[model samples]
Target chain A: MLSTQENAIIIEDLKKSFKNLEVLKGVDLTVRRGNILALLGPNGAGKTTIIRILSTLLHPDNGNVFVNGFDIKTQPQEVRRSIGLTGQFADVDEYLTGLENLLMMGKLYHLSRSVITRRTEELLKKFDLTEAARRPVKTYSGGMRRKLDLAASLIAYPPIVFLDEPTSSLDPRSRLNVWETIKKLLNDGVTVLLTTQHLEEADFLADTIAVINDGRIIAEDTPGRLKSRVGKERLELVIKRQDDFERAVTVITGNDLSHNSAEKTVSLAIENGVNEIQGVLNQLAESGIEVDTLTLRKPTLDDVFMHFTGLKPDEGRNEAA
Target chain B: MNSQLVYKKAYWMAGDVWVLIVRSIKHIYKNYDQLLGLTIQPIMFMLLFRYVFGGAIVVDTGTYVNFLMAGILVQGLAFGSLTTSFSIATDLQRGIIDRLKTLPIASWAVMMGHVTGDLVRNGLQAFILISMGILVGFQPTASALEWIVIAVLIVLFTLAISWIAAIMGLLAKTIESVSWLGFLVIFPLSFASSAFVPTETMPAPLRVFAENQPFTHVIEAIRALTLNRPVGNHLWMALVWCFGIILVSIPIAGYLFRRHGGR
Candidate 1:
């Protein structure tokens, strides 16, 4: 019984802990209807834990959650009925054909036999698994299996779908394919909450990205705003000679310049990339410092994450990978 | 209104169980090798016991083969029920349990569906083992009505054991642990009972343990029914054992199943 004014999902100071480890530390979030909210975080930042709590698979130790306007603690069935969940792993039965997997999901949704049949056919076609419909999932490639997994979640046309790291292990092409499927869901007005460690994924797919670290949402905003919050585009100059580093730094001084001795590069945060780069090049040339390479780098989601968390993305990515 | 909702929920749960049962049965059909593995073990034990160990064991019956048929059926079922464990463990390991948990259906339906599927499989194994027994000169002296009773009792016993297996499946940390746990239980229970030899032949303490175990009662009841012996308290004892297992296991299994959060 969600009112029109209510958000698709709302959380208030949600807390969950396992034994001595507190995974989610009093987190709050709101996902509006028909929007894609990406929960971007490093491993063990409690991204999956939050998704699990929202999907009613795990209960929060304390605090309140409403999914489609139903309290998750007291009205779990109502919450479950309103949401579809595609877990981090592809959860389809390997022995069953792609068609049977979808049909089984449809049956669990309490759809009629005819409706299940029709929906199974439509989903198979939609996910581009029509050719592989009769094949057992064990024989499918990783991308096809993921597609079928997502299709299984949509069998009942739930108002909201939770994709937990849907493209975590997918190759570039397969990730794009899943992104296409997600866009289709958005086109149909189905709200989506996806968790990912990939900044590029959040940048491309999320309407609003929540950057989480150490069990807290450190920053939340649109991807553009998040990147801008870090700083504007950066101007990078790789000096041809190591001795020219000091001169390059002097030219880019008063512009928040950072020098990397190992890479022999000088990077500066700039308000205007073109004008700043022009002035720096003129200054460097007048000072007889030959630049090996110069490029204007736009701010990416990676920069946004590093700026908010104060930790390099690679530090977390290495452990997660 | 609350009662009405409860009834509706029950109705939907039953339907969910049926759907899951169908899915499991389809899996068995597709992977016929597992089913083949199930049927072959009992037949091999029958052959080995009939040929290798038949001459050494002394039985009061006309032929040891007749006495061994019931024993083989009980042993076969005890081992066959492990398939339930492996299947459940695989589901949990592969994240299917989590998917089922998110669905708008009763949680117990997942376990019920698996037990029901294993029941059908155990039934088929029983049918094949009995056929092999008759072919190998094993004879049953039960009347048609008594035979029906034996079949129902065996299926009921299988259902009870499968519930215990389901619990092991949920609690097992890995798929490999499931088989080890099954071996630990099945090896002792099947060997310690009167399944392969008479309790009288065992030493004093071993006899005490073997004579009182639940498997002995079930084997004794099935042997009496098959041998046309006098109707005895073994039948009631077997029913109690089966009912006792179900009563103890259903709640524990359901609790473990609900507690499992798919790792």
Candidate 2:
């Protein structure tokens, strides 16, 4: 269990209103140390606003925030020294080279000359931009640019880093690389507050996930725990032929597997989970329905979000603003 | 804050500024043509004025080159400082300045670094204009120290204006408006001073306008030092002008940045 006191980041009763609309309404959260806390929210759920307060860039209209034991309102410098932020947009100078960006970030951290040099060399290699390090960032591919942004965030080795959609535009290869880097940060015991719309990213990387909608967190839990709360297993059946969909459903439900066929394939919420799934498969084979594929997997974050937000991840994000 | 604490703060603060500069320079290095614009324009203006304006215009100094050189250098420094404003606006638009909001560095360092870049940029503009000045017929009787003081003063002057321009940039709504914004700043400040012609030759009301304006003092101080003439009160007046701009624009820019700039 993570202690509410020992958590690296804590927000209590965070409230902010702009004229008539309230962006954050009495929000509370505790991000445990050495864990990746993915702050999942639709637009206007106040993710950026919360990030601003925790980074000491903005003060909340009401409530308090503590980052790395420093009160953001009173001890801004201490808080600043402790955290790293990579915003949703890449704010890097398009004219600067990949290597220059890291060195400059190193300079901001007040690293000595030799240390900056070593750190720069290390980041270039780590971010896999060794060849492109000297090229101006404007010439870099989108993946390379995002990696540079991520590398810049880590140059200081901050104990806590806030990454808002860090890998949104990255290709799968680069996205996986970013995931691996994030995993490495977890091993090093650095706390990460990540806000991302990519459900798969959250599903794989976040140890603790918070689903925020309408300026409030509707649900918060581990991926598996959150999935279990939906109260059923997800069984996806792929039909070998379009006409076989109805026949497969009869076999699945006949084995006491409750299911919904919303689209191309039929799904079931089964009992004894895998045992029910196994029985359905045997019956389908015996019935000669020629089912193409059958698999049993837990509900993903997408399903969990769908259950809470009443919309898919992309829909929730678009509708948020 | 104690001296040690302040130094520590400023030293760490320099990182944000330093990083911005290094990155900007790398940008400059990549686009050599942009730098070519810096060199090409003054050379064209030098040729245009010296050859065309040379035959008709007459100063007691006899050669039009001397008079033309000073004016070109002054105008180039003023114009060169405008790019700082453009770059600042671009950075703001691109969210580079927005990112700085999240750093641990001193709040003012980002603006300070940008103004310092103007200082350095104007210094380079000074160099190009001077080398071109000599290539015409302008001569300087002062030693290296005099030139250094004059150089520092020009930089300080450019920095003051860049601060003003930067404030305008942060406040501007769109990038297209940046050029117009810069133009608005320069139009009044440039023409109100002795940059174009001597104040004595102007009509009475215009002379008062020129004499009362801060630009006049800057031009007078610059002309006195570079031309090896007596500075008199122009030095004091120039300092007053530079200090006044810094005192006002820095705070105003900081305020605007804090308010509208992303948290």
Candidate 3:
């Protein structure tokens, strides 16, 4: 919050393609120093591609990227020295013990042996992997593997860290554990760029949320501001009979209405939840369409996606490469 | 100032390579099954050739095991280099290579680590085969200086093959393909060369290839050095071949490693 003017990462018109499939169609982004930026996107939305390019693991075909004031193209070594990357898949050495993995990573950074040793111990204890420090990573569970992977990335105490879907496949409990760990990273004044498909994750952790779809950032703002922009509540109604579905659609006045004809359900954005619900019920009564169930909910990232793109999160562009 | 910076860069690169080498060596120690395989395979080859084929294969040397010793040592070392390809391919597949690439360390350290670790492994395997040869009827009549030269030649040959293996690993799409790729390249070189038998008895075409190829010269050089026979031009030819392989392989491997995580 104090360092909002200083940028840890700056990406400009980044474009990349795998063969003919353009993964990033001119992505421009920035991460403020000492802030958590959640790259919110569905699968194959170029979230991972952006992370890869930023980490210097992959090249961008076009545009400029700078990390910690070092150009990604001309000053890659400097950029690498300043950033740590924890990929979507746990990239730690399976044959190495958790402690050995951290030590190896620390040595790769050319840290002194004493610093490496102390950092290794500190990280192992911090991640709650002290008991399993001596065990090979192959023996670890998925959650433990992720924690170790994150720990390995932080061994060098890099200025910036990139986590690509850190909690994608974790169980509920394990997901919470990782969230807590990420919060600790933020508290320690580390800049974080984490990509996640989970709306709640982005809402809970991000200082700034950038919703990416179809290889472009559709929206970027503070979570509260983005929520306010997507201020309309959602009304969902499951109709009693399939025959009433057609009549129900005609009864809905909102142009942003989306319906599943097979399920006999209609969902639409409403400006006023209470008044709109009463109006909808009366209209449905007049139209002789009986609703089986109805629910009103606050707008989430899914609703934000629908409001912005007029497409559901899963309906975003998926390219095969 | 520029020269000093370059020297400093080189110094750090060496340290980086050494660190990665230690990591790679630790992998070999931890993977007991791989170590067991490395041990049992060459010993089995030594025993099989010394006992089963020793009677029929008549060599112009002192004993069958002595002639076979050089072949066995060179062949074992060549085969041991196959693990370099497998390890590199495994690292690539498992994203460890990406992790290494993302670090600020010199890019060449990754390959150097694997290659140097393999050199140590080949050295250890060579020591094992030589001890086993002595335990059997084999005799090496070289002096200490000759032994040193032989060790140098062996290490050079291991480095050459290991670099080529590194190239194969970088080119391979998967760990499974790395095995096939390594076998396709190394199998023919070890078999068609003067590894197990003299090139004179081989068919005219294979004899031509066996005589001209790198591995034959390496085996011949080691054989001459160990037997205290005239090395002739074999040592020069072997050195040229190994250096040639290394010069060609390093750049190709480096390029492939850069393009690796692009996928």
The alpha-carbon RMSD over the true interface for every model, in angstroms, is 2.2, 2.4, 1.9
lDDT of candidate 3 at residue A263, scale 0 to 100: 86
lDDT (CA) per prediction: 0.85, 0.74, 0.86
Interface Cα RMSD of candidate 1: 2.2
* Alpha carbon deviation, residue B135, candidate 2 (Å): 2.0
DockQ in order? 0.50, 0.42, 0.53
Q: Which residue pairs in candidate 1 collide?
A: none
lDDT of residue A267 for candidate 3: 86
Kept native contacts, fraction for each prediction:
0.71, 0.66, 0.71
Considering just chain B, what TM-score does every model have? 0.96, 0.87, 0.94
Model 2, range A121-152, lDDT digits (tens) per residue?
88788767899988888898877777788778
TM-score of each: 0.90, 0.79, 0.89
lDDT of 1 at A269: 67
Q: What is the lDDT of candidate 3?
A: 0.86
lDDT, candidate 1, residue B231?
Answer: 53
In CAPRI terms, model 3 is classed as: medium
Give the CAPRI rating of model 2: acceptable
Across B1-263, the per-residue lDDT of candidate 3 in tens digits comes to 69999997888888888888897798788887987798788899989999998888888887888899888888889888878899888887877878877898876687888898898888888898899999998888999999998999988889888988988888888889988888788889888988888888888988999999998899999999888889999999999999998889888888877777663
